[model samples]
Target: MTATIDRAHAAARRGPVARAYRFELVKLVSQWRIRLLALACWIAPALFVAAVSRQSTLPVDTLFGRWMHATGWAGSLVMLGFAGTWALPLLMSLVAGDVFAAEDRLGTWRHLLVAVRSPRRIFAAKTLASLTVILLLVAGLAVSSAAGGILAVGNQPLVGLDGHLLAAPDAAGRVLLAWVCVLAPTLALAGIGLLGSVALVRSPMGLLLPVLLALALQLAQMLPLPVAVRLALPGYTFIAWTGLFTSPAQPGPLLIGIAVSVVWAATATALAYLLFLRRDFTNPAHDGPGRRAVTLGVLPLAALVAATVAVVAAAGATGPGIEQDKVQRSVATAFSHLYRLQTAQLNRPDVTEAQLAATAACNKGGGRLDARGPGNDWRCVVTWHLPGIEAAGTAVYQLDITPDGRFMADGDGPKEVNGYFLVRTPTGDAPNPLWQFDGNVALLPAAPKG
Candidate 1:
């Protein structure tokens, strides 16, 4: 009897949020769907690594796919790029979008509300639990993919986006950091899903709405919008990880991306909270907030939308687009690194990047010299000095650049010197470092116009 009383006191001391969070967590874990989702997260990455590693053709289009067979770090980065596009948003939506709505479907809203008198506490508990589950799933995927890649292909140094090489240890640390960075935008995305769950009430609508919204935003990002508008988007955060692999490891743009995502998340969650507090659960017949209440809630949502747009537009007016000078420097630097690697592989005289003296002349479509902004038609003529060659050689590289400052350069090279698609190295035939490569420029706002 004394022990039971003590236990009761101990439970009370743990606080309501803790108790509710534990209860929510237990409920989520017990669900078969959640378990299956966890299982898939664990198993899918391993399978993907094994399957891709065995293929003869490399997935060259993906950021790190060219080196997937060369290093486990590359495989992990490849998966990160792919997952950022679709898998992550869908996975987050599945959990956060259903947490609140499930109570409506099960006719348990009143029971839950009665059990937790404070609606605010209930919201905190469920949100925390859902976020916890998301973190677990992400961690599981990262581990499984990394382990599988290492098992399939031995851990080796990785080639950075700027053509610099990262040793295995440094690469591992960066890979881990990259995944950690993913959580910011992912949480922001989860907030949107949570908002849907609270507002939609119906399980199916709650689950699918966030995913559709995310898809729409992703498509919007592809449009040739103003740089500021694109930068303000939550979807841009997904590609923010690219900055971590650059030569100087610029976190400035990545931090800005995170800030934009945080603003979106905080606003969405606030709106969801406002709606949740105003809702009336007494009427079992009603599935969601009252019509009048919804109208009132929408006023704030609309205001938020307008404010966000205004701020983004103002920023866009001052933000820098992909500039010609930055592109030339970025391409030229990467070309020098690739040239060094190509020469080293051929057992030729060792040449340093400084000795190479690489430079690039870039132009956009319509033969616009010194062209600025993102497009597919950008072309660069890159020239470099090489030992044992009489005159300098030039390579024409076709560049497809994105709004986020990442570009893929495809070289129409002098194959006799640089090797075409494949290079004969002492180790074996490998993808020519100079044939094609990726690069990133800093995305920052320009000086405000006078």
Candidate 2:
């Protein structure tokens, strides 16, 4: 009886933030939608892996799709790309966007703010609760996708974007790291959802706004925007994990992407908090955003646009573009490593990358003299010395380069020379290491003019 009384006193002494947080968590736990979303997060990826595993034709369009049947690691990566573009933002919005809007819909905002008598505490509690759910969902998706991939296809060595093969253990580590990297951008989207939740009182509007914005941002990213402009947006970071799989992992863009994402999340969440404070909770008839909502929203959005414009203007002077030399160097190095792997698979005498001495001359826009910048028109001719052969072997490649510093190299060489889409190896017919590859080009300042 004494111990029970002491526990009661302890619960009574809990601070308002803690109490509110507990309340929000309990409410979320009681919701069927939240429960269903959590279940989907865990089960959907597994089902996706199973479905992909049964396909006779691989999704060659996706970065890791060609290897989906060869290794479970590739299956996880293929899912990662798909989730980034579609599932993740929608999932985040469904929860964070509804957290506040639900209270409005249920007419509980007056009680939460007036009866509780602390809007700030309530806001803090709701934000914390929503973020907890979001983080858990993301982590669940990552773990489920990885586990499902391993179960469906087996954890074989993964092929890196830079054409080097990663051991199963190393690939596992990189896959985890890649998932971790995506969390920043995902949180940024959550912040956008939170803003929508507070600013748009209607549940449907709050839930759909962030998803719509994400779609728009993705479309904008695909355009030939300035490098700075593209990098400033959080959407670009969704695919930034590609750099982690490169031969010399390009941490430059990863760090920048994380920093950019943090800034976006901070600013957007702050604006959401400010708007939440200004909301007139006593008015039950407030169906749409009021004058203050429009004012507060416009100010932050305008500032963001101004900052982006300033960055774009500053970057314009440098004439930033994907360098031909960098592309040539990166693709050539990656090709040598892949070639060595292909030879090893065929039981040929082991050859070293140094021995091959590969070199590539790449041109953009169909042999234009000034062959620089990101585009799908880039072409490269690679020449390499083969062991015991007098003439250097040659391969032609076409590159589709994205503005955010990734490129897909498709071998245009004769199938007999470059090998077909699938190559016969001791293990079976695995993906040809030469038919297609991926690589990164670091966005560095161009060389100073002589």
Model 1 misplaced stretches (Cα beyond 4 Å)? 1-14, 290-320, 366-370, 387-390, 417-419, 445-450
Q: Could you tell me which residue pairs clash in candidate 2?
A: none
Query: Compared with the true structure, what per-residue lDDT tens digits does model 1 show for residues 1-450?
Result: 999999999888568889999999999989998899899889999889878977898898888888887788888888888778888888878899899988888889888988988899889999999989999999988888888888889788888989888899999999999888888878877888888888878847668866786787778767767666666667676787888888877675577667777877787787778888877878787667646435644565456555655676665433446788889989999888878778878888888988889999999995854488788899889988876677988888889998767899987767754438888878998778888888986666443568
| Backbone clashes in model 1 | 0
- Kindly provide the TM-score of model 1 when superposed on the true structure, using C-alpha atoms: 0.90
TM-score: model 2 vs. ground truth: 0.90
Instruction: State the lDDT at 157 in candidate 1.
Output: 89
Candidate 2, residues 1-450: lDDT per residue as tens digits? Answer: 999999998777567789889889889978998899899888889888868877998788788888888788888888889889988889878888888889878887767776567888888999999888888888878888888889988989988888888999999999999998898888888888888888888848678867887898889877767667666677767877888898778775576678778877887899899988877677897775667666776577657856854764575523444788889988898899889888987888988898999999999877765777778999999999977899988999999888766788888986854647778878888668788887777664543679
Q: Which candidate is the best by lDDT?
A: 2
**Please, what is the whole-model Cα lDDT of each candidate in the order they appear?**
0.81, 0.82
How does residue 228 of candidate 2 score in lDDT?
Answer: 73
